[model samples]
Target: MRSALIVWGGWNGHDPEECAAIYRRWLHEDGYSVRVETDLQVFADPAIHELSLIIPIYTMSKIDKEPLANLVKAIESGVGLAGHHGGMSDAFRDAVDYQFVVGGQWVAHPGNIIDYTVDVTKPEDPIMQGIPASFPYTSEQYYMHMDPSVEVLATTTFSGQHAAWTKGVVMPVVWKRLYGAGKVFHSTLGHQAKEFENPQMATILRRGINWAARAEA
Candidate 1:
């Protein structure tokens, strides 16, 4: 059986613990041996080396270098990595090396706390396959610092609320990237637990995990 290691908890405001529970249950139903941890040491375990995937639900903290490096090496060797919102993007903000390896960093959400539409850019991708072509929801409209090579699967257009260089910009909301032999999938929409509970959102998450974990095949 494929194993999954979920490291959660950094900023409680994003409800990483709650998000971990939701993911744990979903993945368990899918038949993965899952473990939820708040400690970064979980990354260093040789057992983790055999796992099929690693999902980080952490936001904004420096994970100790040794273990963090261990995880990076694991990902580089083809273990799957997947996450959403600031949990993955804002995580390890001070660790430039980690950010570089992860492929993107959360810079700003220009039009904060507003309703916006999320459009599927590559609807044919496995992650977006079952989702509606377009959908609307009330949440933060993210403006990210992204990697140019990312395969954009979904995006949200921003009609800026206040004057800034990003005013009237169309930005990627969800994307995937290949890091060495591994795969990384990210979504900027999971700022709240309710967001993940959306039917389309859940389906996308499931498919994304499967796609990211595809290397095991």
Candidate 2:
């Protein structure tokens, strides 16, 4: 069976433990052998190199050089990496290498738990199949500094309602990229675990995880 590692813990606001549980259940249902950890030390374990996927739910946490290097090397060696929201993008604020792998970083959420719409820009992509072309969400509308090489699957437009300078600016909501041989996937949704209850968000997240885990195979 395919193995997956979910390393969670950082800021409690993101409910790292709760979010990890939700994904753990889903990964189990998908026939994966899921190993869950709250410590970053797991990244240094030799077995980490054998996993098929890595899901980092940590938010705004510090990672030591040894473990962070191991994690980076593993991903570069083709193990998949996938995450969402501040957990992945906003993690390890001082670590440029981490942000480089993620392809984006959460800079601001202008409205902060307000209503916004996500536009599906690539409905033909398998990760977005069956999701509506557009959908409404009442959450943090993330304004991220993204890497241009990512394959954007979904996007959102800023109304400048909260931040006038950003009005009419289109931002990527969901994207996938490659870090070395690893597949990297990210979504700016899921401020909380409950947000996954939305069918569209849930579908895209699951598909993204599956796609990332498969890597180039």
Candidate 3:
């Protein structure tokens, strides 16, 4: 069976533990031998190099050099990485290298917990297959600083209702990219575990995880 590691714990505001549980369940259902950890120290374990995927639910957390280096090295050597919202995008704000690996960093949420629409931009991509062309969602529509190289899968338009200057701006809602031999998947949704209860949001996240896991083998 494929193996995966879920490292969760950082800002409780994101309900990392709850989110990790949800991911653990789905990963197991998908036939992975899943391991869950609250401590970041596990990133340095020799076994990290053998995992098929890494799911990090850590938000706004600090990481020391040793473990962070190990995590990065593992991904670059073909381990897949997947995450969502502040838990991933906004994690390790002080670590620019981490942000680079993620392909984007969460900067702001203009209308925090407001209604918005996510427009699918790459319906043909397997990660987005079967999802609707567009859907309305209620959450923080993330405003991110993105890496230009990422393959964008979905986007949201800023109505400028909350931030006037952002009116009519289109921002990526979901994306996938590569860091060396590894596949990296990210979505700017899921402020909390409840967001995944939305069928569309949950499907997208699950599909993204599957896509990332296959990047290596």
Query: How would the candidate models be sorted by lDDT, starting from the highest?
Result: 3, 2, 1
lDDT of 1 by residue, 111-149 (tens): 567888899999787678868899986777777787889
Kindly list the per-residue Cα lDDT of model 3 for residues 1-217, writing each as its tens digit: 8889999999999999999999999999999999999999998897798889999999997998888899999889899999899999999899888888999999999878999999999999988989999999999999999999999999999999999999999999999999998999999889999988999899999999888884343
**Regions more than 4 Å wrong, model 1:** 214-217
| Candidate 2 TM-score versus the reference | 0.97
Clashing pairs in 3: none
TM-score of each: 0.94, 0.97, 0.97
lDDT over C-alpha atoms for residue 11 of model 1: 89
Give lDDT for model 2: 0.92
> Worst 10-residue stretch by lDDT in candidate 3?
208-217
In the predicted model 2, the residue pairs found to clash are none
